[model samples]
Target: MPIDIKQFKEASRPLSERVLGFLKDHPEQAYSLMELMAELEGKADAASMAWIVAIERMSGKKEGSATLNKYSKALEELLKQGKVTEAQLQGTTYYAYGGGHP
Candidate 1:
């Protein structure tokens, strides 16, 4: 079945599940960390930025574990499940939500 962000948003699912649903629903759009967090949580701050960075690292960006620890567990789960992918564009990394190519 196809994923639907509206449906997931209306449900009582966890934040991580909603995030996955959003990614699945828009598999073609590339989302940077800030963009994803702003869209998902309405505001981006230290905690959210750290989570994004962690997810970026988990997506295999050239970064160490220190910055990736203690946050972004939801995205880490998605990465483990192979539901998300990363791409480098103009020297910046962006994440897309889908099983296909990034």
Candidate 2:
């Protein structure tokens, strides 16, 4: 399941596959949840996107980005299957390639 960046950007492939492709390409680099969301979505900054969601919820009483939630769920699925590693730094979770069972 070697999904290219284009496929991930266009959402032509499953979220899990797209995530794996990115992790594999980056080797051992750890990416935070928001970082992964930005990569998978081809956005330059996911924090800002999250801020938008926050503003919308606070002012407009609207829901956050569903796609970002989908990415989190997909990552959890990968985590449960031992396909990726999870770590916490400064209280924020980060994900890396391999070693999930540890």
Candidate 3:
């Protein structure tokens, strides 16, 4: 069945937020797309999964391949806007808050 865009947007909100939060907590370390997806799957809804698949298809990529690319892009934008910083991490590459350690 085709997924509704509005529902997808709603579902994606928390997933995106989670992704950003993870990045903010672990700035220096890199993660595979699969790893991130695995982490996301634990908490995301079907709509969130749809977005992940869409991004994966658009990138012509597999799990964990483009994970950092997407993450870096989001982080770069946030950094540029002064909403976040690279100094947030001490040395960790992965972080989970309330969602459990990844």
Local error of candidate 1 at 75, Å? Answer: 1.3
**Tens digit of lDDT per residue, candidate 1, span 7-102?**
555555665676776787887788765566656655556467657567667886565543333225667766777777777889766777867332
Q: State every prediction's TM-score relative to the real structure.
A: 0.54, 0.74, 0.35
RMSD of 3: 9.2
lDDT of 3 by residue, 4-81 (tens): 896577557744466666655776644434455555555355456547667777886655436445655654555465
Put down candidate 2 lDDT per residue, 16-78, tens digits, no spaces: 877877887797699988888877766778786677556656674444556666878888988
Higher-lDDT candidate of 2 and 3: 2
> How many clashing residue pairs are found in candidate 1?
0
Between candidates 2 and 3, name the one with more favorable TM-score: 2
Q: Between 1 and 2, whose lDDT is larger?
A: 2
Predicted structure 3: lDDT: 0.53
TM-score of 2: 0.74
Off by over 4 Å in 3: 1-7, 11-64, 88-90, 93-102
On a 0 to 100 scale, what is the lDDT of residue 3 in model 1?
52
Worst 10 residues of 2 by lDDT: 60-69
Task: Give the distance in Å from residue 37's predicted Cα in candidate 2 to where it truly belongs.
Answer: 0.8
* Clashing pairs in model 1, backbone N/Cα/C closer than 3 A: none
